[model samples]
Target: MRGPASLQGRLSLWLTLGAVLLWAVAAAWTAVHLRHEMDEVFDSALEEAGQRLLPLAVRDIIGREEDDSPDQGVATLREHDEYFTYVVRDAEGQVLLRSHRADLGVFPPFSGIGFADTATHRVYSDAALRGTITISVAEPLAHRWDVAREALIGLALPLTLIVPASLFGVWAAVRAAMAPIRRFRAGIEARGGGDLSPIPAEGLPSEFQPNARAVNLLLDRLRRALEAERSFTANSAHELRTPVAGALAQVQRLIVEAPDEDTRSRARQVEAALQRLARLSEKLMQLARAEGGRLQAETPVDIAPILRILVADMGRDAGGRLEVSLPDAAVIAPIDPDAFAILARNLIENAMRHGAQDATVRVSLSPDGVLRVVNAGPVVPPEQLARVSRPFERGATDAQGSGLGLAIVEAIATGTDGRLELTSPATGRADGFEAKFATNRIETK
Candidate 1:
């Protein structure tokens, strides 16, 4: 049979089996000892009966007025069960007297002296009157066997009761010992996302503490690695922005001062290249901030005002192509203002860049802090819709911009325990794209 699968079950089974085996050995030893002691006691009684009755039988035989037959049965005063019986024999080996229950066939020919065993009885013989008379006492061996059997049964019955109790005790002890392992498993399962805290190993057994320590060491290493990566990304982006902005300014000056139209055209191209570099650097910084999990605010802030300012700033150059809708009440949410502005700006910029020429871009904020941005464009393919939200995964759109916009929005939303939903062919539209940031970390007032 297959053994138990759990550690507790296996330990309990083995311990209980060991206990039962020990009990069985003890019971067997006790039975053997009891049998030897019983034999000694019964033999002593047989010898005593033969020695005491020898002299009495000699006197009775001498006092007889007439001679008896070869075998004479002695009379008894009462009818009762007899466990011990005796016979009196003369010098010629003829039985002169016998007890009422005594059988002549059971006693053997007069052996010299001391105890002897027959087929069904234990016989002890003794002589008196200088070997003229001898008496033999016999006891049934079946009686001794019956007593030993009863004593062994008494020793075996209690083990049947103790087996179950012993098994239960072993199970309880094993389960108690495994409690620390269970707690450690739960601690590991509860960690997710950015939770890199070390699991405590206090009270755990020595054998299991090494596993816990290994896990904690791995988590510490991962935490340091992530911190280093974010720091590098943010620092690199911040350093490049200043130089890129200065270059863009110098290129703009060159474009105006150029005497030839061809020179002006080349300077304009350089300006565009520098501007794109600056935008890419800015996106990298935002990505670093989102990944750092610093998007939460100490108190609720009115995100509606931030959205209004962002839309107004972007709408100036939109040439009447932007449309906005906002709830009359303030949309209070628990999110960093800078992060919210970054998230809002990415949605607006993505829509403006991808929407059809002169098509109106619609931006709406629900009272519950659901921000939706929809733009007129070719419906994104089923396979590409989900992929577009990842970094550098631009769809079939021919827009000129960095592809990190939607990825930054997703990271910020996720960090603050919010959700982002993207749809191709925006709700109730035939050909459009939509980005929905449902910031559930909000408390509208």
Candidate 2:
């Protein structure tokens, strides 16, 4: 069978069907019970009428024996023929008395017992007169049949009205019960994509409160996800713009000055700047993948060794302009090796680009499990300190660097359950960058 089109219609159909089935059962039971009771009432009344008529039958039987003829008794009984049958017989089995219509050949059957059937209630009775005489009474079943027919007719009209009335009541109740669900659906449809607020539960019934709350909770999560995506996009566009513009400017210079050797050397320098821009673009894509929840970094990693490798690589890349200071001890945390390398490389690379030339970059893992990357850079204003953590918002004196470097590091740290912090030097001389990871050791390392 085809299903109902909506919840309200389905619920209404089910309730009406159930009510009809129950009503059929109960109404059938009631009609049968009423017929049975009517039969009982009629049977009792017949028995009572038979009681009053019996003594008259016995007197006529006794009178006939004394008269030696039934002619006189028969004449007296001639007046009552509509509701009775009377016959009398002697001890010799010959007819002694009879009514005007009573035939000697036909007689009512008698069980000879003076009471009704113990199992059924068809009353029977016998009374003895003068030792040898007998009188009997019985109620015919035909009277009870007539009473049942009349009782059924009396109830037919009432049952007809009850069925339709009950069905309408059932439909009304089902509609009222499902009204809240309809309202909730309408509320959802009215909202546009940009409207991510939760559905209100005010004035709703208790049964629908949980449903509204659950839908609102799902909307709340979706809003957060959309907000994070918007942030990633805005930062990506801002960070990518400068490098693209710089590459365009260098290309224009190369076209104009290619014939001169001195101008060619300058073009080569511009080409190097273009290479740095390409690398920055690639790093931004990686950061987007990590932040957008597309990257899965579930693995055991030896973070200390990863950091040592990154420090060594950055030291080589920096030439003699940067020096590395490291702790003698090692520390570990669970992470993807590629992700850890990216994080360490970005943090150290950002420090080297921003700090003073020939400055010492301290790389240390505390015994209590804090990884620190401190470089001696110009102090950042307290008001501007928090802006550096966000993408595309670089500090003063760091104009040549891509703003995405710290943003990528922060994404990695957040994904791995670590914290990134930037602090001003105690004497306000240099800026210090620190990241702390929850500590562990790699079983394989």
lDDT of 1 by residue, 182-251 (tens): 8888889865444667988888999998899999999888878988998999999999999998999899
Best by TM-score: 1
Per-residue lDDT, model 1, residue 322, is 90
The parts of candidate 1 lying over 4 Å away from their true place are 1-195, 203-205
Encode model 2's per-residue lDDT on 1-445: one tens digit a residue. 9968976667767776777677667767877988777656655654565556556666655554464664333555345523333444443445544555544343433446345442323544444454244333333455555566666666556657766776677668867876666677788875433456877667677888988999899888987887678567658856886867777676767857689888777777777777677667767776764465422246554456676777777777777655444445544456677877777777777777777666776666554446667777667777777788788778887347778888887776666556677776523343554433433343332
Pick the lDDT winner.
1
Number of backbone clashes in candidate 1: 0
Residue pairs in collision within model 2: none
TM-score of each: 0.60, 0.44
Which stretches of candidate 2 lie above 4 Å from their native place?
1-36, 55-113, 116-123, 128-146, 149-164, 189-192, 242-250, 260-445
